[model samples]
Target: MNATDRTPADLLRSALAADPARPLVTFYDDATGERVELSVATFANWVAKTANLLQGELSAEPGDRLALLLPAHWQTAVWLLACSSVGVTAEIGGDPAGADLVVAGPDRLDEGLACSGERIALSLAPLGRRFPAAPAGYADYAVEVPSQGDRFAPFVPVDPDSRALVVDGVELTEAQLVERARADAEALGLGPGARLLSGRPYDSWEGVSAGLYAPLAAGGSVVLCRNLDLLDADGLAKRVESERVTRTAE
Candidate 1:
């Protein structure tokens, strides 16, 4: 990316321009033995589709609050960017009762149902399959997202200075989000094409920085690992060697 990039979406656009074919986010679920890798173009497509789903189907608008009740998985990362693309404020672990919409994992089905607005349930299953049956009062994300347009254009332009994210009571404008991410990238010594292996959840500032924003700001890639506690040190070392990881953050 560049110093001028303001939002997470801006960082993504830069990454798409710089290396569309390079792997952007590689995911690993140690307990489930699941591995998925998305190139910039592929990740962009997922973001576009999910953004369409949010805007067109859920009627999500700029400044709308989205409660992200999900684990640190690849799909959760996609949802975060999709919210940013549509100019929605991503609220990490926010209360469903206060949110305009809720995108939830299986474990949070009850919390999702409590939300009066739109609710989308992710199977978080392999290949992003739909739940056997939709959760009560919730749309199955895997079912609805496939038919949406592959290209996304926001109905309203996102303002870089507008509130874009809220994590654990801390609100940040898009510009601030990018600025902190870039600073974190520098602190981590990330350079162009750097590959990072991050075993952190996105519930806090440091985890979000390491797992998502930092890599984008630095023009790098991330290998995001969930259930990392299950991986032995030797196994993780082997993965780092094979994935050519340039840096690591726990």
Candidate 2:
């Protein structure tokens, strides 16, 4: 909660402590006709449960690599933070073959099977449903996550100087991640209580900063839109107004 705090999970804990009822992430998937809003409390609950699943079930340790084979959706966001909570390094679009764990979306199920360690598949449905039947050689994320405790405590202390994220050929430590996020927030003109509407995909640093890290660092919220290209400019503008978006990153 202090200015020196750097880990993403710690930052999120600060956000929840500061304003648990405030909207943290408002997600819209135009392609799927889905919309979901999560307050800090709800988002943290999801993160905690997912973290517990990663640590308690999978035995994730600090500095472990977690390949995130997911798109820019609410569940993917949860997985990213959950990794931070458990001190695992989240590698966006990284190769599963080298990972300690792989969390894949429906489209990546086949690819995920080739992963080295533990594997979990997400249907990425409206409510994070599991596959009709558990995938071969993989755990069902939705089925397992809900059974995890709502609170999570890491088995070992997470080092702020340790690698926390890797994206677009760049690896960042937990402290560096927070530092970059805070800088990106300032660059985007984000401030306390600001709400950002972002249509950027999560594969790049800019997109990840805008959609997740920056807002969290700035004490702001985000409205993350997938398939945003399908929306006309007028419609996008209207949603921004309706959502009270203070900034927009496209």
Candidate 3:
């Protein structure tokens, strides 16, 4: 399915139908520092609950802004899908002055919280690593999402030519970006159960639209390398081989 035609729910449903037993994400736990695996069905439910949070509980709207300063990890997957299901514009440090929501980028957040103040409304900082909890005042991403559960209001049909993601004032229609990504995956010969790795942060919608969503939309698997520094050349080579990754989108 095309980007405008596709939803995060669409991808999850497709993945499950294709092979419910297949491993959708084989994540390396940065917290406990262990390797873990999740099936397509499991991830589908996780994504749905996330969507429920942002849309049902948070009251996020289309064109509303959400910032992600999160490290690349499994929860990153949940948030990206959450944004899509709600039609909220997810950004990564594009315009601190105009942002309605903020997360992760602590310094930018501090400045934004003061600058935007009332304009800067909700903040989603999921806890991990040195961060123990939701940083006190900031709303908890984990608590917000899963608490919302799986049921949600019906999704709005996204405009094919509409801009779905933003970064530094650049606005590319969801169709344009997803089409480009789909073409690349086809040319690279990605297929069912194929694994894709990206050496970049998964917080941005790019990683979802162009990476995970594209592949699973085409019945392929998406794996993320959250820590690049942790994966040097040798480490990367071993990871791909071990994970059976067919290609990478950097």
Off by over 4 Å in 1: none
Residue 150, model 1: lDDT of 86
Candidate 3's TM-score = 0.76
Query: What lDDT tens digits, residue by residue, belong to model 1 across residues 1-250?
Result: 8778888998998889888999989999988899999999999999999999999999999999999999888898899889989899999899999999999999988977778899999989987889999988899998999999989999998899988889877899999999998999999999889999999998988888899889888989999999998998899899999999999998
Alpha-carbon lDDT of model 3: 0.59
User: What TM-score goes with each of the models?
Assistant: 0.98, 0.98, 0.76
Give each model's whole-structure lDDT. Answer: 0.91, 0.92, 0.59
lDDT of 1: 0.91
Residue 73 C-alpha lDDT in model 2? 91
Winning candidate number (lDDT): 2
Better candidate number, 1 or 3, judged by TM-score: 1
Better of 2 and 3 by lDDT: 2
- Residue-wise lDDT of candidate 3 within 7-115, one digit each (tens)? 5545565566667888877666333445656687777777777666665665667767776555555665666666666666666554555665555434444554532
In Å, residue 118's CA in model 1 sits off its true spot by 0.2
- Candidate 1 residue 98 Cα shift, in angstroms, is 0.5
For 134-225, candidate 2 gives per-residue lDDT tens digits of 88888899899888899888989888999999999989999999999999999999988999999999999899999999999999999999
Which candidate order results from sorting by TM-score in descending order?
1, 2, 3
